[model samples]
Target chain A: MNVAVIGLGLIGGSLLQALEAAGHAVTGYDADPATRELAEKDGRNVAGSVAEAAAGAEIVALAVPLPVLPGVIAELAGYDGLITDVTSVKGPVRALGIRRFVGGHPMAGKETSGYAAADPALFDGCAWVLCLEPGETDLDDWLTAAALFTALGARVVPATAAEHDRAVAEISHVPHLLAAALARRLVGNPLAAALGAGSFRDGTRVAGTRAELIAAMCGGNATATREVLTAVIDDLRQRLDELSAADPVEALIPALREAGDARRAWPPKPGAAAEEPAGAEELLALGRAGGWVTAVSESRVTVRTMRPESDRITP
Target chain B: MNVAVIGLGLIGGSLLQALEAAGHAVTGYDADPATRELAEKDGRNVAGSVAEAAAGAEIVALAVPLPVLPGVIAELAGYDGLITDVTSVKGPVRALGIRRFVGGHPMAGKETSGYAAADPALFDGCAWVLCLEPGETDLDDWLTAAALFTALGARVVPATAAEHDRAVAEISHVPHLLAAALARRLVGNPLAAALGAGSFRDGTRVAGTRAELIAAMCGGNATATREVLTAVIDDLRQRLDELSAADPVEALIPALREAGDARRAWPPKPGAAAEEPAGAEELLALGRAGGWVTAVSESRVTVRTMRPESDRITP
Candidate 1:
């Protein structure tokens, strides 16, 4: 397979190296001249521009940052080949309605940025989400993307753009805000800051991320992020009210126990493996059931589901 | 100095070992026979009861769980020697009005709790808070406790019980609740659970803590926790509303930047060292200013303050 990755940043550079190592002819490009020079110096197949990169490629991966995505998307107008992106947010990109486009976001990253920090094994054992919108996304292209990621040692998760956005808002975007909030509380109270230990450090770890990147990710998916943030706030506010009650320990024990049980049972254990020739809806169903695609063929998809006991949410 | 450490769980056992390593005559006791036998087998001076351990000791340290603390406090009804506690909450213990008592809480712990997991170096480089209520606490006892913890390689942070409770709520207790709330969000969403990565893992790290311990710690400091939690919720709510605006990225950039700045500046760098013969009021002021006691003598206390530029909160 011939692959073109635009924007030689951390994710893009990593994908290029990983795909090349997996026997794909990968052409890489970056708007920054120094980055392209670095990649060229490093002996990667560096393309001068997006057109030159995508000219002979079967799959074109847009690995640019969110702010740069629109211009890149516009530049690729009328190519008619399979396209995918590695942007964190999915809804806005999916709404672009590009022909044969499959939205992708690999759930992996590092504190460092740029092509200099790229590693071929960054995606190994990571969950790579591939958006499969009903009646919109091309199945063959989606399968090719899944196969490409699977060969690089990533488990492919199938979902619609809406599901991807909401899931990430719950797991990623909102968490960044929560971390920032926790970090902000330490500001005027130096005594509290001095007392911060493992819990405080871990809770606010992501708060160290660049502010602009967090704002763009959370703001790009504002509606979903807001909804999830509201739900979390509601849960916390209820706990606050309970703490204010006459018997806080007794009032909050049941809820805290439920949370603890759910947390302890998390990243649920994989159970039975089932495979069948599946369409878009079927693949989405498997994903919603806490399952991931172990392998994908032209006619069939194999998924492993979680154990029954661990699958259910604690009531 | 002679010291008695009661309750041989993780913190108690670790404190006992650390104190003994510092060359104190340390006698330990636990209500559980198995724990006492384990300590005795380990060549520790294990006593059958709290009374036996406290007998003829210059200082009695209660390292019991919060629930067990009241019982131990009751048992020490007539103890006239210097006393201190390692309970996370300090207000209730300070309110107990025990003579010659200094309330203490070490900002250090491990996930595993038992005598077997004890380490002599557990408190090294950790902040051990000692409560010094203005008129209620004895200055000599407070200084003695500070000297003892400082000798054990722990920084002594002098604060009033109210101040200590409020600070912990902001830094520790509330962060635990936030981690629990974040963990609870993944309860029913398998897709979200699969998407969990560094941010989710770090943000929810403390959710793995025992539910009962969390409930007691957060509940015991209910008033302070509630106040700090409400402030955090308010901050998050403002961000949610900002995300709903016409230009969310623009609306949220300023607040996010401030938070990022605070986080990055965190741990304000240590500046000049100051020494003075301080009383309870002066020591409390130094703690409030984020200065920690390095050494304590009968006449003077040596304290280090943070760099001026990093000490101010981002406006």
Candidate 2:
């Protein structure tokens, strides 16, 4: 496979290294001459410009910042090869309406950025989202792009561009915004800042990410991000209001329980297969919805159960 | 020192073990007979009643639920000993006005609770807030309480009851609500639940904490908690509104930078001395103010400066 990754930043550089390690013939280019020089000095195949990088490649991946991607895509529109991007948001990329272009976003990153932070193992076991619109890329090109990412040790997930945007808004973009906003609350209080512990650190860990990158992501996916944020604000406002109710503690139980259930339902290890509960068969025989018995206290027995097929499927 | 720990729950049980480990004559009691029996079976001094536990003790620590602390304190008020608590909020505890009572809160816990989850190392490297009113505990008692917590491997921080409540509202209580509310947003989204990764998992980790415990904290400190939540909502709304601006990416930079600064300023390893920065002196000399330099990018250097002395000293 002949591959070219343009814009040699963290994602681009790491993708180049991973592709080359997987035995693909790879060329890389960056608009920044310093980045290109660094990659060239590291014995990587460095191209002088976008045209030179895409010249002989069967696939071209634009790994530039989110806001700069559309312009880069436009520059390489003449190329007949399969094109994809490593941007966090997919709606704008899909809206570009470029032929042979399939939007992609690998769910992997660190707090640091740039060419210096790139590593061949960055995409290992990461989820690489592919916006597989039938009209955009032919079946062969789609399969080729998916196969390339899989070979790079990513779990390739296929979804529509809209679905990708919505899911990312809920799980990634909104969480990042929430983290940043929560961290900002501590800015005025030095004592609170000094006394922060595990919860404070873990909750705001993503806020320490490179500012421009996060800013671009939030800006690019503004509508979806804002929609989630609006809903979140309403939910939080209701929670705060409930704190003043006659039975504040009782009123909070349902919301807290739902949050706990949703959190526990999330897979601990990403990309791992959902495991079958131990003793699931016996529990199913005794109850309508059942799985394994997780714990037992003096007053109650706690069992974790999966919903029945009837209950799981909505009307 | 003779110590009595009322309420053999997670915090109480852990305090009992830590005090006993520190060579104090410790006695434990719980309203639940089963908990007392379990502790006694484990070779602990499990007293049958509050009277038995408080008898001949120099320090009596109340580790019960927030609402129950006042009642327990009232019950043992006749005892001529220093009374303290491990509640999350301090204002209400201070208002109890029991003789020799100084509000105390251990800034440590886990999702799991009760004696079964107790460990002597629970207090290690955690911050213990002590509320010292000039008229309450004498100098000797204050020193004694501080020394006991320090010996249990905690960093004893002294603050007024009001300061303690406000700071905890900004740091712990409000963050817990933010986490639970964020997690609650994903309750109905199956894709978001499945796709939740490090950010979602870590950001919402505290939502899995016991509902009753968090409810108690929020309900008990309704004023401070609500104030922080209101301010947080305003900040978040401003951030969300910024995402829709003409230069959304640029607009998000300050918020992201502030978030990063606050997160970085949090003491990395808790209970350790603040380490001097490598180039802080140079930066301080160059600038009008000095603080922790949070992030450095290609174009910007972000620093978090303390408020001016006049501003910090509120009238």
Candidate 3:
């Protein structure tokens, strides 16, 4: 398949490389001449302009930042091609004046960006989210984009634009904001943070955020982000209030157990935590949940959390 | 060196295997006779009681829940041993307990726990935090625990319990509260959540928490946890209020930029905001302060403020 990728920075560069490596013809386009030059030097096909990139491409991957997608999409409206974006939030992409585009966001990443950090296996075994507008099915580029995602080993999930926005707001955006905000307090405190452990690192791993990109995302998706953050803050505040209301505050343990259970429920893969390896304690948290018997090792299994109230080490 | 592991559950069992692997004579102990029996069968030297575990042992690791640490400390009052705990929080542990114990928490973990998940490498390259009491230098066992942690590839830093607590609250526990509380809103909205993307997962990952544990942590550490949560909520509320203040919210993007910068300035890693490996776009929350540059490879990188402003991606 032939692909035209917009934005040529980290996501675009990686997508171009991945597509080309997978035996697909790929062309890259970016507004920044430097970025374009870098992509060209990297040996991927480079386009002089947006139109040239999408001229005859089967799939168009808009690797532009979310804030820039609308204008970029408007530029591509004249082209008749299957279009998708590697943007995080999907709602605005469709709601905005984008044309001939099916929203696709691949759940894969690394902290570092630019063409240098693009990993070929970035999207492998991850969820590739596809959001479609009501009348977007007939677009051939949408189908091609979905195929490209599948070829990259991502499970394509179809959703509406609003659904995508709200979902991301709830999960990705809110966490990033909280981490950033939380890390703010660490500014002055030395002793507290100097002895900072892994939990702090893992929790605030996303603390120092990029100003421009986040500002753009927040500015564009403020409504959804606000709603999601509001709900999250409320939930957390309520729990905290409940703890404050409790006598002797014995509720903290149960809270940890529940929090641990919840955290464990989500990531079933290895290398999920910031610094910890795949742990036997994850099963211990589950065992602490109830009679949920899980094998820690092939032979040395230990059960925990007999009932929800207490944790007994099962010999 | 001989090691005695108290509370033969996840941390305990893991300690047993880890200590054995590290060439330590490990004697495992648990209050539960059954757990002790299980430890005996699991191929570790199972001690009959907490005293037996601590008696003549070079190092004693209290791998129990936070709320129970005081009782464990009380039980250890007579024994002259170097003590450490694997509990996530340290403030209460130090305040409620005696000396001869170096408060060490390995910033290592998983969502799961128990003997099955136990591995020696769980502590590899992780931060094993050590909090010094008023007179930490006098304890002989302190050096033993520190050596054990150092051997595990963990960077040992001395800190106060309050410092450790606040740090963990900011980084680990607080994040858990955020994740769980955020997840709660989605519990009833599974359909919407089912359509959710990577951001949703990343944000609420800790939301699938252990109910009892969360309850306990919040209940017991309400003062510290509430303080942190309140700060977070208050900060957000203020931002929202400023955002939706009136018709002229001119300072919206600037405010977001400041917030993003705050996020970037925190945690001060090589690339703060850029470190987020998964999501829609490059989420630059705060300018440079937040260090929140998590590249969401899928969907949209949604950002929110109370105002109705949109970011203009630089052309």
Candidate 4:
């Protein structure tokens, strides 16, 4: 199979490497001559122009930045092949009205960007969203893309473009905004920055992400993002109001408990570092309460009674 | 030196262990008998009552929750020794007018609490804030407390109680509120949880922290916390309003760039995982840009000209 990837940056460069490793002949092109040179230096075929890359290719993937995506898509309108994108947002792209277009978003990214930071293993065990319209794209075409994504160690989930946009707004886009907001709050406070520990660092880590990329993403899906943000702000306002109640501490109990439980139950990230052994049933159960493992160690064999639910605050 | 720790939970238990390891004879007391038993089981000296722990102890450290701190201070009024606390907030505590009192807060904690999670190395290389008033606590007493904190492998930062509270509001307390708010948004959304990646997980990790503990900390410092929250919400509201602007993406540039720059320069957490080797200066420099090491790899040394600022989005 021949695959042509346009815009040889992080996602494009990485897709070139991974697709080639998966036994596909991959070609790449970028508007920037330096980026094309970088791809050639990485031992991948580099096309002189977008038309050259799209010629005689079975699949063409658009991996460009969101701001320049429309121009790239317009250039690729003459290509007669399966088309997909790796953009974080999908609603506006779906309205682009390109033939054989199937929207995709690899739910994976690093804090860094460009071909230099590209890794073939970037998409390994990651969730990849596939936006499909039945009347526009046949099942065979969608299946082909899904199979290729799976070959690159991705778990493909099929959804409509609107569904994908809403989900990304709640999970990815708004989280970035929150991180950036928190970092903005810390701008002039050196003492706070010096005192920021694991929690603060973890909470604001995403704030270091690219500014334009975030702007393009949030701007492209303004309606969905705004809707989610409105709901989130309303929830937060309710929480803030409770802080001024007669029994503020008592009022906080339910909200805190619910949030804690929801956060605790959220599935752990795939390929996350395993802090404990994977085999849980065989290991001695020290104790459990309120869905939290009270105590379990590698060498300890004593199994104590479970603590009360009130005592187990977090998992 | 004789030290009394009047709480045996995570912070108190760890303080006792670290202090004992630093060659101080320590006595511990807890309001709950179970906590005192846990301390005794760990082979630490346990006192029968708060008065018993305070009797003849040269230093009394109150490590109880914020709500009960005043009562604990009142109980120790007759001890006539240097008094300190481990509460997250310090302004209200400083107003208690206790003689020879110096406020301290260690910038180190875990989501999971209790004596079981306590480790003697918990505070190693952590920022420990010490609050001292010129006329209230003599320099000699403050120096004594500072020396002990230094002995336990802490970088002691001396500040006024009000300064400490304001900083904590921005860095620690408000971050918790944001995390809780994000987690609350995720409560009913299963697809979002399944698709949530590193950013969402890290941003909301603190949402799983104990409820009562957060309530106590926030309620204890309501004035400072509310002040910081108001500013943060204002910043967020301004950003949100820009989503509807004529050129939304262009408008997002300033806020995003400011956040990215601030987050980039924020000091890495003390004792964080060493990403690169500690001795980077000795190694041949590949390149440097904007206070960041542009490129360094073990494979080969290839130096390239830095890209323009507009093109260099993510670091």
Candidate topping lDDT: 1
Candidate 4 deviant stretches above 4 angstroms: A34-46, A111-121, A134-140, A268-315, B17-26, B31-46, B95-99, B110-122, B133-140, B268-315
Model 3 chain B weakest lDDT span, ten residues long: B303-312
lDDT of 2 by residue, B117-226 (tens): 99999989676776666555564565567668877877556666777787778777888888987788666554455456888888899888877777877777888888
Global lDDT for candidate 1? 0.85
lDDT of 4 by residue, A1-315 (tens): 899999878888899999999899999998999888888888899999888899889999999876687788778767889999998888888887878888889888776889998899988877777776646655556656766886787766566677678878887778888888888866756567657776678888888888987888887878788888777777767667777777766776788878888788776333211122312221112111111122233333321122223333454
True contacts kept of 2: 0.65
Q: State the lDDT of candidate 1 residue by residue for A1-315, as single tens digits.
A: 999999889999999999999999999999999999999998899988888899889999999877788788777775668999998889888877778899998988887989999999999988888999888888878888888897898878899988999999988899999999999987778888788777888889889888888888899999899999999999999899889889898888877887788778776776655564557887897778767776776454543323234555566
**What TM-score does structure 3 among the candidates reach?**
0.60
lDDT (10s digit) by residue, model 3, range B1-315: 878888877667776887788888888887778777666776778877788778888778899887577788778877886777887777667766566677777777776876666777776655566665544434334445555766665544445566566656666666667666655544434324433445455556555555665556555566777778888888776555543544212434454455455444443332211223221122112211222111222222232211001122234
**What stretches of model 2 exceed 4 Å from their correct place?**
A20-24, A32-47, A111-121, A134-140, A268-315, B20-25, B34-47, B110-121, B134-141, B268-315
Chain A TM-scores, candidates in order: 0.92, 0.79, 0.74, 0.79
Better of 3 and 4 by DockQ: 4
- Evaluation by TM-score, superior candidate among 2 and 3: 2
Model 3, position B259, has a per-residue lDDT of 49
Residue by residue across A1-315, what tens digits does model 3's lDDT show?
A: 778988877677778888888899888898998888887787778999898998888778888876587678777866876777877777656667555667777767777888777777777756566665555544234335555666676544455667667766666666666665666665544334434444455555554556455555554567787787776666666666676664634544554455455445443222211111112333223322322221122222222111222223345
CAPRI quality level assigned to candidate 1 from its DockQ score = medium
State the lDDT at B297 in candidate 3.
27
Please identify which of the two predictions, 1 or 4, would achieve the higher DockQ against the true structure: 1
Query: What are the DockQ scores of the candidates, in order?
Result: 0.71, 0.33, 0.16, 0.26
DockQ of candidate 4 relative to the true structure: 0.26
A85, model 1: CA deviation in Å?
A: 1.7
